[model samples]
Target: MLNAKSEIQKDTFEPASDNLSERSSILTEMFRKALFRNRVQLVGGILFAIGTPLIFRFGFDQLPINSSALSNTIVGSIFALTCGFFFFRRLIDYPGTEGIAYAIPIFAVTYGATVIVFLFLRLDYSRYLLGASYFLTVVWFTCISIGMVRLRTLRIGIVPGGSANALLSLPSVKWREIREVSEPTENLNAVVVDLDHSFPTEWERFITETAVSGTPVFDVKHLRETLTGRLEIEHLSENTLGSLNPDHMYLRGKQAIDRVLALLVIVLLAPFFAIIILAIQLDSPGPAIFRQKRMGYRGSIFTVYKFRTMRAEQVGSVDDRDRAITKAEDDRITRLGHFLRRTRIDELPQVLNILRGEMSWIGPRPEAVPLSMWYEKELPFYRYRHIVHPGISGWAQVMQGHVASTDEVLEKLHYDFYYIKNFSPWLDILIVLKTIRTILTGFGAK
Candidate 1:
């Protein structure tokens, strides 16, 4: 067991001399404020990355202002740089340091879109200019992230009592316990307290004053959810924040977009799908497509599709509940099935489910009918996950993949609740980026 007070005292930094410390503090604050400001980072990125290149290319008379090359360069550079910048900013707010890992791929997607547009329109553009912009954009953000990591240490003040001590176990945060009402608060990034716990009058007054004095106050439960990307709900009413009720408008809009994109993906990947189907058939004597009943959108039953990676004969003899659980090194998985599952090629057919409005590109992954039924019986409010459409790639899938045991599923439920509670474009974008990593690295596939 950890002693919260001792741990916090050990982590706190002590100053040397009053005058020397004051001068150093002033300089550090000024540097931190300037460097960490979003506007400063944006302006610096645009000027150094986009503006410098523009000056050399067009300002030097090497390219005319009205020329197609000049226009394409401006449009493409600005598009890639701005998109990458904001995407990085949003992702950094989520828990984890892997936000920097996404910088390259985000730039790649934005720049690739520009190239695709230029090709389709038959417009003349300097490939070298766009490529350089992509490179510079990535380098700029990466450097800024590294600088922030080195310069910034989050100092969060924890109010002693209740479950506040539970947060001490979390890493990368400077935890300072507020023992006295008179404890200094100016240096603290935020104040964390267990809102559920009743505090004495002095501490209560301190919390009120802390909030009114401009320092942010956070409930320990919410802060932990933000830091860990998991939401553990002991009761249905614990979701009183109405995070249980996601943006209805976004949900509807997402479904429409999912349908259109699903159709487009199917159309574009038709030939590739044929190749996979042929490979599967050649490897095993079974139907190329595997269909299973799954619990989907709002507890509805739907048939989910996947490329058959398992032998046909072996699947029927097992019990439905037992068969639904894919154990590690399960022999039922054929040689090709292992590769397919690892790369998630087997899930490609779920585009059909998305087209049918039974699923989305991202949300909670649906479970097999038998498994879903069993879980709903064992777990509290399990059907609440079906409130949103089931997804192909989701928070739980990326965070803790391919779980089977009820204990593991309990933890997976927390991830799902986090997704449902914080359901929005940012979380969805994070899932998409993480899913790309999952595809390449096979982090969570069975």
Candidate 2:
């Protein structure tokens, strides 16, 4: 039978093994992750947008401008602000008008959701001009999305000013030169780069996040020979750059924002929060509020609080990465605590952490001490994240969704840097609004 089959066909086959294919698969994953952030961005953008109307509806019920006019003005202002931020895409092309497309849709949804929710809860759309707000948001996003699709700004180039996100963050990508790059997506930024070089997925993620204007991109072949000094991976070709930033870390402004936000949260959520605390006491034999030593703002150790989500027996069962990072159906989670964790009510206890000067309203999340030290020893600027104070929600939480690997930490750090470099009260407010949406959607709670 073997001889007959061999004589009949005599064909030998081998599975595929191409370096470029390997690289492409890795990077494509990052790109997909990066693009997913837009979901959060979109939701956050919508909340701030729609929430504005709710505020105005409450505040300016008797105002000079009509609801439609007010919505248009705010949307116009948002478009105007974001439009100017573009570089190569904005300059020669329809930069200003393009981003309006995304802005408008998000704003529209936000206004609709916000006004509706407020009306449902508070019964006061009398002030909001919901129709006008929704119209403006729709119009704005339409314009912005059109511009983005045309410019493909998020699709190519060397990106900066945000987290060290995976290249996959961009919505779509197709290789102009398959021989040069393997991944499917890229950022469209001011930095003109030739993808005519190969890079590993981790390095590709770093370049998308940390490679800045002055850092010269080396041809893959030239990296070892031409580049000198402590060869920053940012200067290397996409191929040589490894899986992810082992050293990626960030610290945002901690003191002032934390104080204000924690106090405010405690005051606002006090009653509901008390019940959560009570539920924790009923569920297990531990403190209702679990306070554990964590690495914070620059790796400094501090106690971070939460309503104990796990049983006491499970407390030491799993490590932080395995145990603490919740999945969709983690059994370690308690019954009442399940609702709390899903709703992010478990985090409400952290407002006390903010009050205690351990974290900010927004920034990188605090790592457990052992995890922090372990990462620091292995990672390249892992401790740099602590340059500022830790935050409750920062660039990483909203942008990257959740952390799973050392590679994710590196990717997230790029985003943390972007937020830190451009830290502002406005950004904090934006994050807070986004946090609300995250809680509602439970986008990355797992």
Task: List TM-score per model, in order.
Answer: 0.87, 0.53
| Over 4 Å off, model 1 | 1-29, 54-72, 112-127, 238-241, 316-319
Tens-place lDDT per residue, model 2, 227-346, is 110123353345433422322322224465458767887898889877777778887778787777888865678888888887777766324646645556778778877777667777
Q: Evaluate model 1: give its TM-score.
A: 0.87
**Which candidate number has the best lDDT?**
1
lDDT of 2 at 312: 70
Q: Which candidate is the best by TM-score?
A: 1
Clashes of 1: 0
Single out the weakest 10-residue window by summed lDDT for candidate 2.
Answer: 1-10
What's model 2's TM-score?
0.53
